[model samples]
Target chain A: MEHSGKPNKIRLSTNPTNEALSKLKIGDIVYLDGVVYTGREGVYMRAIEDGEPIPMDLPAESAANFHCSPAAVQNEDGSFNMGAVTATASFRFSKWIGAWFKMSGAKLILGKGGMSPEDYKKHFVPNGAIYLTTVGYGTGALLGRGVKQVRALHWRKELGLAQAIWVIEVENFGPFIVESDLEGNSLFERENAKIAENLSKAYEGTRPAVLKRFGETDDRKDELI
Target chain B: MISIDLIQQTAETLMDKAAIEIPDDYLDGLKKTASQEDGDLSSFVLQAMLENYQAAKEDRRAMCGDTGCPRWYVKMGNEAQIEGGAIALEAALRRATANATNGVPLRPNRVHPLWRTDHDNNVGIGAPEIEYGFEPGGDWVDLITVHKGGLFGTDYRMLFPSDGIEGIKRFYLDCLVAFGKRGLACQPAIIGIGLGGSKDTCMVLGKRAACLRVVGDKNPDPKIAALEDEFKELGNSIGMGAMGFVGKSMVIDCNIEVGYCHTGGMQMSVHAFCLSSRRAVARVFGDGRVEYRTDPDWFTDYQRRDTVEWNIPENQTKSA
Candidate 1:
């Protein structure tokens, strides 16, 4: 749990079908050094519906658009291009965890916004899964971390950038918080419940002027009309 | 007759003046927030932001490249007459907008919804978003222009109107919680809360509030002042810390602007600007008079010292 120069590490195995879900803990820090596929909103939705392959490599023309190269790729300066691979928002793809684990062997999820099903905390803790939230609106800072390689697997080319799976090598890709752990405590759920509760209280308490002006309800009563 | 050419020229001048005037207040607020806190991370972020401001000022570059949708608030006098009226006003705005885009070298930020074409000068369908109001006594128009600087990420996406008065408190908390969850490491960021408008309009108002001067400055309404204080306290208490990781202060100032709403519905929009809340307001009179205004206390140490590279056009003279 102490901070070292290297990223926090977690070991994941995929020999058995259920191994991916069985090995995770509630609050374990994980560093996924191996290759993992990347998918965002549209790709995840399509994958869940059609079971498509995510592409792992960018075309030669597309490669030039990359902000950084893969860690294995070297520049004229002889330094590793360590790019941070961010996971897309969790809520957009929360329902596809089973499919993602089945295909990609993804051990870590990196993103900014929180996830759903407040009780997923226990699911994460016991299953060796973790959700890490990167800083919001700091894509430049995240991109500055560098890139070594871009890889994708099993996605339609027509989908263009949105469908490709990005396998990026990141250095110390953290300062992220665990929203869901193997123990099933979901930060997103906790936050939403708090929001819903506060919203309910506010709804019951205030009688804004607009409500009276609009006559309160849509129900058409003869007397009011 | 109001000339479109004249309005365009005025808009350009207003934008140029805004660019140099706004960053100082933002930088000062960031520094003040960081100094009040007791943490290494918060301090580091603040220092970095200050450096960012310095570099931007030195190069005469933008504090943050986003330089969001330029918003214009126009107040016209009932007695004031435009030769072409709204048409003249629109032409003036478009001209000023084009000038600003070229002059600032501003990023072509606007995009067409269906076509997705970049409006190279930050002008697009319903863009350089303008709001119009009329005052009874004036013979001319007064324009307040604000260009907000920040990344429009999830913060822009999370806005929802409150169902009722009770919704106001929740809306307030939602903003703070959203900031805590996703905000940067810097504290004392400007929180703009707009209550009552259509969904999009409310959000724009929230951003406009952020682009306005800090609280304890000037706002016409006392009710708004009270709400600002309440929200500020509530937001700071979230323990989101500087930059929202965990710290004593979460925001430097909270500004709330209330607008008229239709019956039975109230909307609240919240926008958070990072510690560097770059904002400038210009008051232009009917007779071609213009004055630049900033929060008096902001960047007090740096006031009256022209460290920023402000290339005011030599031909254009400042009104006395």
Candidate 2:
């Protein structure tokens, strides 16, 4: 178990070399090297609704064309970086799709906004998936690092930017903090618990009248003017 | 009789001039703000402000590429007469659009909602928005140019009055949680708030209000000003650590714009202009005198940070 650049001992559903992921418990820092797909709001929605297959053949430059396959992160070490393949904002999509992502063989999800605690623990962890995020709106800079690859999948023509799927090879990808793992523990859940605790304390400090004021509805038509 | 062609030509010239003409006042203001914002958030804001100046000066590019659909808000005198005022205004805008597309290479942002067709020249149905106001004794038309920067994404957070005090706190907390979760989302971004309006108007005002701030300038309304302060404090308290864990500054400025609303409920909208609230404005009078508005320190700061000498290009410095 080399500690230098390997992923901290975690379970992975898929093996680095085989299509079928094998169970591994060794505490090895696995630097991810393989084909990863990129998708965002538009891409996720279209695929879920239309049952479209992810395009794995399109070039990286045309990722924006399908809305789902435009972005990729190349590691500084010449390996497929998991920098930008995090999950799309999961809350925006239906719950059923979480399982769909697992079925699609998407080993890593990269996005800024986190997902529901239950969903990550239940769906992502058991399925051997990981989440990562990049600097938001740093797409311009991030994209600058992307090497254009051939598109592996395409879909409806009417979908334009929303229509294709691309399989990208990334390298030396990340220093991403793990929010959820195969064990089902999550950072988001911990944070939410703290928020809930704080809210409760604040509520206890407030008087009933003040709490009532919070409930008072202002229906005045003049307020808007 | 001046034909629409002349108006079109003049409008095009003004737009082109507006694109490059960096106002002395704006440059100075930017520099001042950058110098003062020694804090974690202000630094990034200052850097963003300076970057805008550099990009504009180096490439002679429009400060913000969006350069929002050309808009002309004109006040006409009651007694003023023209051969073809409306048509001239239209043609002038058309010409301006053409010039901007080629000269600035601005993004063709205009698209039909339903058809999704690109208005190749940044022109669309009733676009390059122009609004008219009439004054009884006014003698000349006064023109103002406004360019909007950035787009709406995870960088911004919108809050409503109904969101409650707890909700407000939660909103800020949520942003931090999101930032922590996603790494750094957007930094040196301008935080714009539209306090009260219809849903659509709230969003629009949020964007407009963000655009109104003069770099480091604070809001005038005491209540709203206080809210801005709270937001700033809460944002820093999270220790997102400037630029999402990096030592760079976090937010540049928080601008609040409030409007009267018919709906009893408050609708708050927020827009984040990523470290590049690249915006520029110009006022052109009928007498051919032009005044550009931007913070003056902007120029000095650019010189200081980029170590580039600040010289108002001779061609651009001349009075319009």
What DockQ does every candidate get? 0.07, 0.08
- Stretches of candidate 2 off by over 4 Å are A1-90, A94-96, A99-103, A147-156, A162-225, B1-189, B193-206, B219-231, B234-251, B257-278, B282-320
DockQ score for model 2: 0.08
What TM-score would candidate 2 get against the native?
A: 0.53
Tens digits of per-residue lDDT for model 1, B103-174: 664544566766556545667788888877655344556666766544421132222343544456654654
The CA lDDT at A224 in model 2 is 11
Q: What is the C-alpha lDDT profile of model 2 across B1-320, one tens digit per residue?
A: 23445455556655654554444434564455457444432243344345545545554554433344555555454444445667766667667776665555454556677776654566778767765555443234544444443322233334445556555455434444344322333454556666666777777666655554555566666787787876755554443332333222344556677667665465556665543344444334444444544431111122223234545446534531
- Fnat for model 2? 0.04
Candidate 2 residue-pair clash tally? 65
What TM-score goes with each of the models?
0.54, 0.53
